[model samples]
Target: MWSWVLHRITGVAIFFFLLVHILDTALVRVSPEAYNAVIGTYQTPIMGLGEVALVGAIVFHAFNGLRIILIDFWSKGTKYQKVMFYVVIALWVITMLGFTPRHLINVFSH
Candidate 1:
């Protein structure tokens, strides 16, 4: 269902983020100035939005991974997978609420 699709999407999203993160981090060793320039670009409002998306992808991926683990290891998890997806959603909302305000302020108040 939708959870399966989203789980895959988030997994891919996280993988790409990590790939970019590794490459960008490697720039630090090659040229400090280049790394600083790249880091400066990340401070923009557009990249701030990307940061939010990154956070969401990470949160969803973590919760969905937990769900998959339960489904694999727990006898009754498959029976309640939908309920667990809802639980993951609720947690995501709560986690986003806690983060969005602070991140927005940091993104915009500068």
Candidate 2:
């Protein structure tokens, strides 16, 4: 139940993020200085936290989607849904562990 709610929330977040990212990146073609300024704002500590959250949302959404796929395709996946959810969570944690250190280093390097 929590997974379902989280999956939906992350999906919406990623969707909106994609829209904003595209628009922001498009500013590069319009004006270099504008783009640089926007990019500079992303370097802030809060934005760094947002970046971590964005990564989390992406990873969780992806793994959960794969879990859904497995539940649809595998013959016994329904019976093992709990296990699959745990696998998704474990993978998500591992992915975050791998990403967080480097991201934090870069974030605080300023």
On lDDT, the candidate that comes out on top is 2
List TM-score per model, in order.
0.97, 0.95
- lDDT score, residue 1, model 1? 88
Candidate 2's residue-wise lDDT over 1-110, tens digit each?
Answer: 98899999999999999999999999999999999999889989999999999999999999999999989999998999999999999999999999999999999998
Worst 10 residues of 1 by lDDT: 56-65
Worst 10 residues of 2 by lDDT: 37-46
Provide the lDDT at 109 for model 1: 87
Give the alpha carbon lDDT tens digit for every residue of 1-110 in model 1: 89889989998898999999999999999999999999999999999999999999899889888998999999999999989999999999999999988999999988
Error of 1 at 100 (Å): 0.7
Question: Model 2: how far is 17 from its true place, Å?
Answer: 0.8
How does residue 65 of candidate 1 score in lDDT? Answer: 88
List candidate 2 segments past 4 Å from native.
none
lDDT for position 34 in model 1: 99
